[model samples]
Target: MLRFALFVLFGSVFAGCASIQPYYTPNPDIAANEVEDYEGPLDAELVAGTNIAQRIARREAADYAFIGSAAFTGAADEDWTSAMVRLGRTLKTEKIDYFTWYAGTDTATGMTSVPVMRTSFGTVWGPDGPRTVPVTMLDTDWLPYSYTVPRYEYRVLYYKKRKEPLPMGIRYEWPGEELGRRIGTRKALEITLVVPGRTGWKNDLFDGDVILAVNGRTPTKELMRQFCRAPAGGKLKIWRDGQIVEKTISADPSEGK
Candidate 1:
């Protein structure tokens, strides 16, 4: 009974405090002397811990640039997938392209109070010729119930995924990711990432939109790269909402030259 009451009292308070804040700190050295444009989360990739170690041992760090890292605390019951997706949407705004994470448990303390009620028998002198009456009263107990919470300290390292391994920004659907999402189920480059609040997003070009043609030419892997790297004053035909729509190209970052 005590434990149940305690939990009921503290459940809301605990849930309110459950939010995880990933405090991101970037390596200043890399921040100052790196590429200016950072594509959105669609271009970022998550790395396995073992793969990170192998890449370092092989001196292949040049393939990707180490950007920075973030440290956060999470409860033992927290979901890693939810955390990563939330982080991807927010952290990539800082231009983080690649990331890896690990965690360890630590003991943390929590405190709350449960209100207790007591029942007693009181005699009424004048009511119904002194009948026994049951009286309920607040215990006025301020005693707090305290317990320990298991906390996980998490660390995430961020990197800029160079395009050498997997092409950034866009991916083609030819036995590839998004193959099932190809426009008309035909081969096309699926737009997965676009800088938020930019001309592209402003003009209705967004992730999941498909590039059916560029400047009256069929899209190839190379052509897709050209269009994204330095697009300027051209007709970009895209497939969206089961309709062929054309977006005006401008010299925006990562949009083209």
Candidate 2:
């Protein structure tokens, strides 16, 4: 009888402890009304280390993925096919934390597509690395001037030896190697093209010398357009080693004149 009474008393004590005041409180940073904002368990979905592929996949589905239309030709160093392959490989590896949205390329023309999303998502990774969406573009009037923005976005416009290089911009790099940082700038396309001998690009007096200027203008896009109608083999002045070099064209060079 004594043991049974003791057991009953212990059970009563445990039950009473179980019903103690609800004393657990949230930290000051988290407001009571904001608890619903957390969708998943805490600390479960953060990206800790480098998972290049996973990051790309998540960004691919994000609304901030390349939006609208971006030029996707194979003329430059990075063409549509190459970009798609790279991006697809990135998506295949990364573990997705959330279903942000989707981005695609046009099947016909190979243009890159923009992100489609319902709710706002955060930083997403690309083949390059993690990136945040441009929050400013969400505003109403930011559309019209936007077209000019990407044109000047510096990229390495790498092209074939004979063709023009394309643009591929990077945000950060090692110190003192900041090249190809801008596209539409005045000197963005500055390059040294070697001219062949005795050809239209050769200097008149100095054999094998380059035919630098065309129609009294330097080798620039604006100048080329102005002299478009002029015939090839036209007289041009060039500067080499800070000296004025003159050349006589033997044949007409198209496009670039």
Candidate 3:
């Protein structure tokens, strides 16, 4: 009986010791060699709660936050509707979640690298073009003090329109290569392949392998956004087992699955 009592006491003490031990999770802020959209796991306590606008505000300035632009596609003409449509799709995919005007030079000869933001909204291709406004005039419901502020500053809105087809095609890359410039190239784009269960092909996609391309296109920030449009059930061209293998992969938003 005394031996039984002593064992019980020891077990209780051991359980208490285990209960008090600290828990550890990987730090999301650590600069990973590979590029990722979010700083940490989407499931992380802080990240899961953050909204799209908040993410943009954290990365860029108040002015830059509101406005988003992708380089204009197709030939420029009196008709700018095509550009607007393309801009809308890009904005939707980015979850910019709001709308605004498109900005560019009159000729449209030189365009910005990713996209260009305009101070105000105006007609796409009317005789006078879209009306323009100041960035300071813009307002955001997400902003904490937008109501109480003395003078509000402006932000740029993304505008994609329907335009005629261009002779040359263009593409964009994301999580942007800009990240590669910050962290070393060795850590670039090496993430565990998250896909739906139990197919012979998916099992072959072991973690730590690098993605060489998507349908023979270089993985760019813009290209990734396009890829997200058809995210699930797409063919992934990856380098594995000392060779390149094309595998079909699917991941839904619900599971991050």
Candidate 4:
């Protein structure tokens, strides 16, 4: 009876140890060097007119047109219409078109339970004296694992038509490239277009101009947002032809550009 009790106690201890141990395995689906790269064309092409000139004319006639694209990070099951409405409200515009959406790879890590095999070697009493026996048991325990996952990015081209004039008559890169005149000395955000004769304010700013600052402050994301929301115009410090020049911007409240 005492020997049987010892065996039961030994089994209980082995079970407890097995339950506490952990096992881990690599997730095979995600590779170490895997990255999300978007090679497709941006949703900037006009959806209305047939030729470039006609497209520009149609866009100018519209109250607002999506000139460029912006991206927003969201969940896999995120509702797109609601997101668009929210974005429009934030930008103070109701018109949006030329929409594009996609998902990108992200990484997630967590601990989870996994099954493992536990083996034990011990001695047991038998009719032929002490006998060695090998025992194997299937068990489950918690382990840490990491892998790449898919996250959604919502992108769209939006336009706004309002009587209020636009603060600036230029189209800038939303994720703009940083340009410098003297390497580390003179830096500015690259501007893509300055519509000729479309600006509300009177200034000598032109297309391909690099903006260094706005109203004497360094241009930042928040500053850009302020510019977008501003009904009136502001000052712009531009880098043109190896010189920094200040231009006073005005707003045009007309329906057409």
Which of the numbered candidates is closest to the native, going by highest lDDT? 1
What is candidate 1's local distance difference test score? 0.51
Residue 97 Cα positional deviation in candidate 3, in Å, after optimal superposition: 31
Off by over 4 Å in 4: 1-165, 174-187, 225-234, 250-257
- Candidate 4, residues 91-144, lDDT tens digits: the string is 443434432334677788999999999999999998889988999999999999
Model 4 lDDT, residue 219, Cα: 77
The TM-score of candidate 1 is 0.35
Question: Under the 3 Å rule for N, CA and C atoms, how many clashes does model 3 have?
Answer: 32
State how far residue 29 of model 3 sits from its true place (Å): 11
lDDT of 3 by residue, 1-257 (tens): 01111011234444433322212222232223322232211110112332544444332321122234332222223223323333333233222222223343333233224334446644454577666544524333322221221221112223111121110111111223654444333222443322233222233555445556765676654454345454364665665545667766564443222
> What lDDT does each candidate get?
0.51, 0.29, 0.34, 0.49
Please give the lDDT score for candidate 4: 0.49
**Could you arrange the candidates by TM-score from highest to lowest?**
1, 4, 3, 2
lDDT of 1 by residue, 1-257 (tens): 01111011134444544475567776553443333334343333344443443332122123344456666666666654344435544444322233334454455555556677999999888845887889998775555455555665555555554444222333333324555454455556666444444445556676667777888887776776566555454678888767878877665444224
TM-score on alpha carbons, each prediction: 0.35, 0.23, 0.24, 0.34
lDDT of 3 at 248: 66
Model 1 misplaced regions, further than 4 Å: 1-23, 28-33, 43-52, 55-62, 78-128, 131-143, 161-257
